[model samples]
Target: MRKSRIARSGARRPAVATGAAAVAAALLAGGFTAVPAQAATGTDDPAKALHLGPKEKLVPQGTITDADGTVHTRYERTYDGLPVIGGDLVVQQTRDGRVQDVDKATEAPIKVPTTKAKVTPPAARRSAESLAPSAAGGGSPIVQDQAPRKVIWAAGGKPVLAYETVIGGTQPGGAPSELHVVTDATTGRKLADWQAVETGEGNSMYSGRVKVGSVKIGGQWVLRDQDRGNMQVFNMRGGLDEDSAPAFRNAKDVWGNGKPTIAQTAAVDAEYGAAVAWDFYKKVLHRNGIKGNGKAPKLYVHYDNNQANAFWLDSCFCMHYGDGLDNKTPVTSIDIAAHEMTHGVTSATAKLRYTNSESGGLNEATSDILGTAVEFYAKNPKNPGNYLIGEQVNLLGNGQPLRYMDRPSRDAEANRAEGWPPSADYWKPGIGKEDMHFSSGIGNHFFYLLAEGSGKKTINGVHYDSPTYDHKPVTGIGRDAAVKIWYKALTEHMTSTTDYHGARAATLKAARDLYGTKSKQYKAVQRAWDGVNVN
Candidate 1:
């Protein structure tokens, strides 16, 4: 199902919330960005979940159509006939008709002295452009194009008549940005100001016998990717910080001896992984680089002594790899490298938290999904791609993969001693409550089900048996299609608070956008979620 790309602004709305009811209490606690409400009852006349007083009016502002064809209508509120500044709210309903009252403000109704603005609109516009934030938000100001809009500033503690100004500008990195400033109508004083543009930064190794970028520095060939973001691999022997761990520089162009004894061996792996991962994002996914910026991030290898792990640090905007037990094996395999780097991508895109039940699992699962995609995209004959995480590292020293997507529970007994609980093969209530690495099975299973479909299959010599929760058969739409849908959802649709259900909706929406709502791929997404019991 291919549909013409059509963009429609503005909206149509009917009062209602869909899904579950407990979300009402959770919303008040800020537990969810959007929740399944009570729209399960009726579609024609959805129940008004938002209990607005008679004096208040809900003015529709914008709308978003989800992949499942559910309309999320955004609205602004007015009290006593005056618009409430920052009183933006959204009524989100999923395909199943689960609706919820989603809004930023959960405080009591606001009361302003009057709707009259003492400060003239022209004066407000002038101040909006001239008033540089007390602290630089890091940008040269662009002139505000529109006039200051009059509204009641009830978003803050107390309601006050005010003028809201939208100031345009470019961020330090030249990304277009907007600064929203709210000023008190009575006085010209700035009440609040914030940058509306968001930017995130964060980047990886193991590959079997691979090609890497090198640079000539002081007559020495350094492990730096001059071609791709200058991604350098540093030797973090034991100390922390880049100061102690200088980058690997070889007197000759040749690097590594294919043995763990040679320090450059691990560096070779890390550097190659970084180069491949970088190319994977740039060529395969069409992402320029991590954070979608062309600049490459730093890489730290041989992280801690005998520390069998690897990770990405968004703060340092670098990827770190550790040596396995006895410091003989480095955890810088292709999948490991792509996996850690994908963490940074997740940070930059959805900004998913590293903690929490559902979101945390999603944050980790995202890395695994994209990492596998990068591995497959690389098409390395030596390291053929498989639906396995950390397959090359041998973390348990048993030749067993870290987490198995087809049947996540397979790694249970092997990794159990490492404090990993048995992973769920399918979604169940509280599945996300497990360790993220294990809980991620729900998403992992969904992806596998989407990419390869259910039951027995073999790819790259790796056999897998994936089962459906309801014992129903699922037909795959192709690995490429599944990867595309997941990527689109993660970058464009997913948010920080997205849970398994939300993830399903986001992917469905992505599939619909890419293949149309009625396409086999769209139906595959639904079937995949059903296989995982997400719906």
Candidate 2:
């Protein structure tokens, strides 16, 4: 959910298709692998009942029961007792055990032998290092154990015996790197490699010097919340290296002076954002934390020199923020904080691929939706909840917000006439070329229409003019109900490869589960999708 610069063009490009093709090519070239598929006609446990092809065994990972009593079961695939790296799928079934849908990452069969590989572990390590020299740091690659597994070589090609090697080191750009290299075990030929690092970026006492949880350890007041599972915030002090950053401590619990001149100001903001986000999920959604396991993620503020972005790194299991615009504006606003952490939630739950168009767009939209929800939940007087994202941060430097959910097209800088990107009004073929941030407008616009309806309106002293692609007005379902439907769809209905159409179906199912099939909310969900032209 990293927001990059927007592409200002009306050209129609198939970025998603092209990116998917690139991913497939990477898989064949030994860069990344695909999961296996499971098709079950009977029983609730698809992992036990589904036919996963020769020598393959599916292990149930997790199960989510929808409001309507339907079950979505996730499974990990293995071949001949060896774990398959990318072989995972979800099976949907009704309360009576009737199978409704089977969402699989790959449908290929795995029939590879699990016998000891002909190639030595040293040789496999050398092969992986050769494939990713940047990960070796011009020295010996810290390769982990080589596990034998079955992986799909091509789109429909038969599964082959491969050695999955884990290489750990630092990349050339100084970022921590962990590469998963797949090599043909019999021939020692490299198949694919993928970076496991999930990069993301945050702010200050911008929430108006609010009370933060702190503890006095060794007579020093530390930014550690003992109440919230000892969650701690560290001050990077404009440093790029995270390992060396120190925690912000003060003589008294009071921190920040409403300005970035004081380092604790940003830490105060970050700590506050984390606290609110944690409470929002716990209280509003009944989820414990980002991973829903009652554990807190590391928070680091003032990362890098004048860094203008905030990111969440899976490798560190933490969130980092950069000071934007002369190192004064911190990106740690409540919505932005919630947005970045939501990426972590998405990673733990759906595990959606960030490169695929539809899934990637959905991924970004999910963050925006939940982040906005967090803002509404907080109701901070200094930073009141609104449809505008990063409004207080002034990321653009012109005082305009980073994005506007109520009117997504209004984000288009060049085409101010229509207030939207030229090709984003409808979900047609090839709209994927639009940046994930921009393509996200499609979903954002849909949510706005669903929650507030179409046309012009003003809320919280903010003006918004929204329009439908088909000129069909949608009835408002209110943000609270809409968010519940979305959360259900995201946590219970969505899979790894869900696209816009999949999202529409998932939301409809969520609505049916929550409000019944014939309820107004169910119909509103459909109308909202239609308004965005997702249907």
Candidate 3:
């Protein structure tokens, strides 16, 4: 019934209007005049000019208050009471409300023809469900997670009325599925749908006898940490359905004996990884679980037999780990846990789509970058932090790391059948078009060069030989500053559709926000992008 309706509907998508500068200038002297200092200093306060229409509203997504009495608040805009995709922005100012700067996902106008949808809800769900497959074919049961909601599609160079639906299923692989589908409400055409399937830690196995968090439930110890957003780990034991899965329990609160075969071992790793990540965000980055709300999604381990990979799904708002090549090799490690969980962080902040070419690579790289930092922050001697991702798990089965930051090309996709190069040592045009795992090398290499500089060196018993695209020497700004700058750019500036070039601009803006525009730290960010050939 709805299938015939979908086939009949076809309309051209509207183009995004580009007049942000004219709007900004017009608002500079409007009744909502900025403070004297803001006007005198000529700060670009997009928030002051946010009154594009009365129906438009700015809802706060996050706020950062600094020790120097500066405030930065990120907001998501709603058009005609409908969520406006790609309509998020951040406003920064002094304590006295003197505007400093603003960052937005898009500068396009938000007006549309109307809020009514020609495509009915049932029609949209049918269209989205048609894209999903059977359970055996890597899809969920024929059940809608929720009713499809109307939204404004603005990321694809235009703003159009649409329907956003969450489909229930696993991707082609047996990972939890949260395939977000955006359907044109007028034409019934599918605009975009993303399944973040492509890609933790902890363990007594990897981190080695690490401290874990547990809570008492009905006088019995259950593997749940109340501090880190009440993160609870469930043992799948080669099953699905987390609601029925049992949580690892202990009478004395001693979780694992440090054995991979033991189910509790993976639980310990998951708990430890969550703790370290929570601590890392709070202490180093000054961030909480999601938007500082202290709410982390559930974590499920041993998801499927020989699952071999881990994934974060928006449907369950949870992270799932696999039993790896063999049942004995659970893929839970500190960096791995941090890596998967950072997917959650990226979703909550930048909302970077895992399907887009460039955004997907950045999404993966963001996880790798932050995951590496989490490992280094743990100070766990058994699992020392390094630029190499998944070194403890050794997924390659050759005692080699999954992906190398200092030298990404070292582990390119050897299987030409996969249709991607080994890896890229430096950024090149269309690098985003490469496999997200390998394309992520561009970001990884840039970060490595920025933190350690371009040269051969040894740290923590691991050797690194980082190079640059221009073959010029790029000075190290230290990982401490690099991580800070990256986290800032990700949370405050980046958008869902941000590409490599956009990343260059976002990080530079972040550096200017943190250190002065003239500071050496700012220069390091510019040089780092240049080293990656992003310029």
Per TM-score, the best of the predicted structures is: 3
Better of 1 and 3 by TM-score: 3
Off by over 4 Å in 3: 1-48, 132-146, 196-205, 216-219, 413-420
Each prediction's whole-model lDDT (CA): 0.66, 0.68, 0.71
Candidate 3, residues 1-535, lDDT tens digits: the string is: 0000001011111121122332233223221213332221234433346445666766555456677877666666677778787787767777777767766677788878999888899998888777544311443424244568888887777789998766544444445444567889998888876654446321123677777778888889998888788888998888766766788888888877777757898888777887898899889987767446677778888877666677666435677787765777777788887887788788777877776467778888899999899999999998878998777665545666667899888775532433446767776777766656667788888788778888899989999888787888889889999998888888877877788888888889888878989998899888888988898
For all predictions, the C-alpha RMSD in Å is 15.3, 8.4, 8.1
> What TM-score do all the candidates reach, one by one?
0.65, 0.78, 0.85
- lDDT winner: 3
lDDT of 2 by residue, 438-470 (tens): 677788888888899998888888888888889
Ordered list by lDDT, greatest first: 3, 2, 1
Name the regions of candidate 2 deviating beyond 4 angstroms: 1-48, 65-71, 80-87, 92-102, 106-205, 414-423
TM-score of 2: 0.78
